[model samples]
Target: TEMFESDNVDLKKQMQTYNGLDHPFSIGDELLVENSQFLLKMKTDMPNVVVFTFNDTSSWKSDMNIYKAHSGFTLEAQNLPNDINLLGKDAPSILQKDQAFYSRTTYQIIEKLL
Candidate 1:
């Protein structure tokens, strides 16, 4: 996929700058998604599929992995409760370089607009 390869190439350089915290995401990590508490449990084999448990109860699946250059991994919920705004938004095409992070390899979250 050209989109995949292009993002991977672009993010590789960006990820090299950060050393403190891993960027994009980490498994079992809790994040303030749309100003709400959410846990990124795990990544699945399905394309962009991930187990994102919201509030530790209701689990929602969506494309949430930063494979090469995809970012802003969104949930599959139609309308998130509590006025959470996970959908109806666009991930920035290129995240600020300072936001880049490295895991086993360098990567960035490509804006995934819905």
Candidate 2:
């Protein structure tokens, strides 16, 4: 697993057993060994861990309610369309700014099956 530090330093540390990384990290940073099972517990709220797999994890799992409790929000590939009408002379400029914000919110979700 690799950690992108707040101070712009990238630390790559791979763990084999339970005596690995203890501190909170980002982006599914865990043991990279194959056929290994590990339990992850989020001790603090400051760290943001993002795990994005190409597979649809919810479909194969029979009970998703248990997994839902672990994650904050499991969002699928979707487009949140918002239509805002500005009834003023500054409509054009505001629309431009709004488009930029909308674009920022959007992210391309790559699915393995798709």
Candidate 3:
């Protein structure tokens, strides 16, 4: 399986920053979601979604290459329950250059909240 959360320090830092700015964002309450451009892992203990702002994540390129590779990808988020060890793979993520966002392309967030 393709793994997005590699226990990398930089990615961890980005996740921390995403949980900043005096705000709380959750899809269904207390669900911590570690996400890439096309993959997401959700946990109940942590309530956050790591947003990836790239058309493609270099990290999962190899994992994805294993498959035939279709035209588009899915916004996948598998639930990793309490104390459950898991990591992996999204939804439409909006990002503004003003804020700290992990991105590879040149794009801007039109509206602050969507």
Q: Specify the highest-TM-score model's number.
A: 3
Better of 1 and 2 by lDDT: 1
* Candidate 1 per-residue lDDT over residues 35-79, each given as its tens digit: 233323332222222212221211334467323323333433211
Best by lDDT: 3
Model 3 lDDT per residue over 1-114, tens place: 122344666545544554212222345532332334332334333334333333333457465464332223332222322213333222223334686743222222232232
> lDDT for each of the candidates?
0.31, 0.29, 0.35
Give the per-residue Cα lDDT of candidate 3 at 91.
Answer: 25
Q: Kindly report the root-mean-square deviation of model 3 from the true structure over all alpha carbons.
A: 16.9
Error of 3 at 75 (Å): 4.3
- 66 in model 1: Cα distance from truth in Å? 22
Distance from true position, residue 57, model 2, in Å?
21
**Cα lDDT of model 3 overall?**
0.35
